[model samples]
Target: MEIIKTAIDGVVIIKPRIFTDSRGYFFESFSQREFDEKVRPIQFVQDNESKSSYGVMRGLHYQKMPYTQSKLVRCVRGRVLDVAVDIRRGSPTFGRHVAAELSEDNHLQLFIPRGFAHGFAVLSDEAVFQYKCDNFYEPQSEGGIQLIDDTLGIDWRIPTDHAILSEKDIKRTKLADTPLDFDYNEDLYKK
Candidate 1:
């Protein structure tokens, strides 16, 4: 597996080695030992999956304090423009973001660490997305920033006029106005 770092400290893109034969291809999607060596040691406790059609924009979402989660995300079918934004106040990359393409063809994955907001927009006719989180879901601790905030300038890979969003997303605040209490630092995970 190849672990590629993003501009923001903890954001990483993972590319697993694929072996192909006459039948097809095979790869190891996750391995604890490899993870401990190539990435941070996250004890994933939950898994989630979602299916969406083109133009569907799902997030810029995170959890607060006790329920904070770091995630490893991937696309199992079709494609998408996956994104992560730093919401850690007082950090060098605060409000910064990294965007990458994940698809069935490439079979790549993105790791968005804790203290960040994550979301994705479908770039194909449809996509089946899957992810693993180091923590469990806690609806009461949910928090998010508007996916369309102009300050972040993320082009959801779909037209704003036609993009699909939930009612909750429509009222989300910008990063600057969100109630964030986390901060980013490489050493935060080192310890």
Candidate 2:
């Protein structure tokens, strides 16, 4: 696997070396040894999967301190525009974002570290998304920024009228108004 760093400090794109033959295609999707050496060491505790249709937008979400999560995500059945936003208050890249397209053909994975907000938008008719999280989810610690916040300049790749969102997502506050708990100087990876 090749670990490609993104504009932000810890976010990255992982491309697997795939082999194809008469039978089919094969690739090692995840290897703990390689991941630890290539990227930062992390013990992903939970795996989550979700299925969504075109224009479905899920987040710009993160968890508060003590329950914050880092995620390795990929799209298996279709395509999606995955986004990560830096929300650390005093960081140089704060309020900035990185967007990548993940799909079945590419087999690319995005690693989003603890202090960022993560989200995705389905671009195909249907998409099956999966991710490994470093921390177990705590609903009480959930926090998010409005996906449509103009200041963030995120292009979700879905038309406003065509996008579908949950009531919870629709009610999220803008980045400036959101109560962020992560600190730029804190070492989020510390155990």
Which candidate ranks first by TM-score, i.e. highest? 2
The best candidate by lDDT is 2
- Clash pairs of candidate 1? none
For candidate 2, what is the TM-score? 0.99
1-191 per-residue lDDT for model 2 (tens digits): 99999999899999999999999999999999999999988999999999999999999889999899999999999999999999998999999999999999999999999999999999999999999999999999999989999999988889999999999999999999998888899998787
Give the C-alpha miss distance for residue 57 in model 1, angstroms. Answer: 0.1
Which stretch of 10 consecutive residues in model 2 shows the poorest summed lDDT? 182-191
RMSD of 2: 0.6
lDDT of 1: 0.90
**Candidate 2 wrong stretches, greater than 4 Å:** none
lDDT of 1 at 75: 100
lDDT for every model? 0.90, 0.95
